[model samples]
Target: MAETFAPVQPDNRMAAMSIVAATCFIALSTLFAKMLTTDALGPALSPFQVSHGRFVFALLFFVVGVAVIRPRLTRPHWGLHLARTGCGWGGVTLMFAAVAFIPMADATALSFTSPVFTLIFAVVLLGETVGWVRWAAVAVALTGAAVLLRPTPESFQPAALLALGAAVAMGTENIWIKKLTRREGRLQILLVNNLVGVVIASAALLAVGWQSPTSAQWGALAGVGLSMATAQSFYINGMARADASFVAPFIYGTLVFAALYDAVIFGAVPDWVSWLGAAIIVAGALLLAWREGRKRPTRLHPVAGVVK
Candidate 1:
């Protein structure tokens, strides 16, 4: 039998640090991306270029990290790696579009829907059982998204939909990563996942034709890559040492950074209603974390078809 880890006591304090590190990096990256898109690089820069720059940096970072850390890059599961790559690229493409249009906080808030999609996919695709409480938590989270989007208006921006697409892609990516980690080392998994992104983004850039990014623009693009690479590395290291359920709530804390970035960088404060919606979203994320924390850690699930 697999050694069942205790739910509350995780092995890696460093992992917690990684999660925190990712939050900070993501927040800063959001601000940089907003600046790059709005001020330095115009919307004409295209999602393809943005994604290409992001993956290129991430791939370089992962490769260098593996060289220094000496993590084995065994190709244990190419198929799973490919799935994660596709999902990651899709999520990035959609999110870049969303961020280009919507406020960062709003985009972040909408992205929370991923966990809900994950939970549902777990039940349907993985055949995992979920109780009423989990279901209730999912509903609360969806309701919060509804409030934020206010779908009643046709004038509602498509950025909201793009955000949802990103969330769905990310949710699928998460499920696959959880499965991949079961048989793969954290660094190795990251290497393959990032390489996939680099390849896909490269193809997109080629098809769209590459842009000559200015020094400042390159920095923003590099920031996207560096921040994303750092965040994933930290998050995986943290998860290795801690219960995912315990660490999941910290993921929501990214919103605090998002709010700060929006306020200080763009002076893009969310309205009262938006704030309320954000609160609900955070609350739902917390509930989901609490729910997962209460459960016993079982053997990690196997990788399958995409969840969302």
Candidate 2:
């Protein structure tokens, strides 16, 4: 007799809930990042320092994970790992910097535009076709981004551009992670990712001035690392268990969490513009995602982390 194994079935409900949990963690990570950039916590730390803490602490978490599980190792693809970690670090750092200057709600909404950028990257990097439907979707998302930017002198914030840059970097990371997941196990991918990330972040941190983080600052930095690590775990699980599009819409909940966290912690309430711009971005992203899902049911996957 041959031994048989149980095949896992898709549980849409669990996957959706997992995405919600991931969003909550991602928003919490942003809140912790914002707290670090404020003097109220202690000495305000630069985004480079914040990013450094994220990679270092997140690496520790993974190291503990590896020691406990002792995952099977494979030949490392150092170049691909470097590219993915480089983009991830850049995206994380820019978003951290942006949140320091603008409301988290606004920053989260702007970062949501990354899916559109991913579509553009797919076209160039993978030779994927973009018909009129995708182009229109991209245009709608960009328009929403413009609304979020508030281009007028009284409302314009240069820091918002940093958020947009983060989106671009994340979109590019999406391309690289897609390639990586094809050949690597999740544990291997994540382990190599953070290992490379710490190296890159350390180099950047050294170039910038470093100060000993205060006790409160250390707490905030630890929060950023742990929350983000938790988020990446849940996000990967969710994507593994469901079709990407089926769970992708649930990610918009990050904006809601960000706004709620902002209100409760920072007392920064999102006005009509924030709501409208966020609504528009979500609409366009959903449209684009669903359209692609119909065309290619099993191929789509979200970026490695929730919103990072």
Listed in order, each prediction's TM-score against the native is 0.74, 0.72
Best by lDDT: 2
lDDT of each: 0.68, 0.71
Which of the numbered candidates is closest to the native, going by highest TM-score?
1
Root-mean-square deviation (CA) per prediction: 6.3, 6.7
Candidate 2 regions with alpha-carbon error over 4 angstroms = 1-21, 92-112, 127-166, 237-253, 281-308
**What's the true lDDT of residue 118 in model 2?**
70
**Candidate 1 Cα outliers beyond 4 Å, as residue runs:** 1-24, 41-44, 94-112, 126-129, 148-152, 155-166, 238-256, 288-308
Candidate 1 local lDDT, residue 248: 43
Query: Residue 239 CA error for candidate 1 (Å)?
Result: 5.3
Q: How many backbone clashes does candidate 2 have?
A: 0
- How many clashes in each candidate? 1, 0
lDDT of 2 by residue, 203-287 (tens): 9888987989998899889989989888877766665555443443456557667777878887988789867867775686567
